[model samples]
Target: MKRTKKERQQLLQETISENPFITDEELAEKFQVSIQTIRLDRLELSIPELRERIKNVAAKQFEENVKSLSLEEVVGEIIDIETDRYAISIFDVKEEHVFARNAIARGHHLFAQANSLAVAVIDAEVVLTAKASIQYVRPVRLGERVVAKAKVNEISAARTIVEVISSVGNETVFMGTFNMHRSM
Candidate 1:
């Protein structure tokens, strides 16, 4: 049965509240309604779009806490960050990121994404990767969206340890642990 507008709106609010990253298309499919209806419902509820919600959450979480690198230098778009603790970034693999013949992404791109994220999570003005141990678990193809999560496992006055795991969907494609040196 089709849900009444008020009922659907209430359900939509609850769904989005549970998962702010839910897309309008997904909500539309779940509600058995048109995407336009979902958009209208969201607008009426004063809920921002996915991108806006992500930005808002990230800004609120990491505004002044990240001091190591500017946001633009982080290689991928940072979706979440808690300085000196954890960070998450997303990188969309395009044609340029892949090998022309195989359509498999170059390993360096994944490394850069993880490395930059590790650097970005430090709470110091000067941060550098003193060493890293990395492994590629699977081959990522072109057009894949890779999400990298970096968590700081240990921190000292001289150095910090950050572990980064990059995934496509639920499968981990790359993993790395970075030993970072922080100066001041």
Candidate 2:
């Protein structure tokens, strides 16, 4: 069934509110409309684009939550962070991150994405990964987006244990256990 202009706009507002990271192209596909229509609807509704939305959310969340690393120092776009709890980030595998011959992303990029997030979740003035045990489950290809989730498993006066798992969709690409040194 077709929805009226008002109804479509209302639904667009709800959809974008629920998932601010959704792109215009995805909205267009879901609403069965052209990308131009989504853009027009967004303009009329005063909704910013996906990049701006992500930046806005990240900025607000990071200000009060992340303590160890500045936003610019993060290896990827951090979508959520809770100090001494859990945090999540997204890294898009680009051509520069992959080997030219295989188009497979290098392992260090994934490690950095997870390691930075581990540090970001520490509720301390200074934080550093003192030891790490990591496993690479699969090779991520160029253009794949990796979502890294880090959780604080334990915390002591002088150390924190963080578990980080990175995935492309439902499949795990890499996993790491980081022992971080923290100082108040």
Best prediction by TM-score? 2
lDDT (CA) per prediction: 0.92, 0.94
lDDT of 2 by residue, 1-184 (tens): 9999999999999999999989999999999999999999999999998878987888789987777778999999998887889998999999899988999999999999999999999988899889999999999999999999999999988999999999999999999999999999
Q: What tens-digit string does per-residue lDDT give for candidate 1 at 1-184?
A: 8789999999999999899889999999999989999999999999999999897777666667877777778788889998888999999999999999999999999999999999989989899999999999999998899999999999988999999999999999999999999998
What lDDT score is found at residue 152 in candidate 1? 97
Candidate 2 clash pair list: none
Q: How close is candidate 1 to the true structure, as a TM-score?
A: 0.78
lDDT assessment of candidate 2: 0.94
The parts of candidate 1 lying over 4 Å away from their true place are: 1-38, 43-47
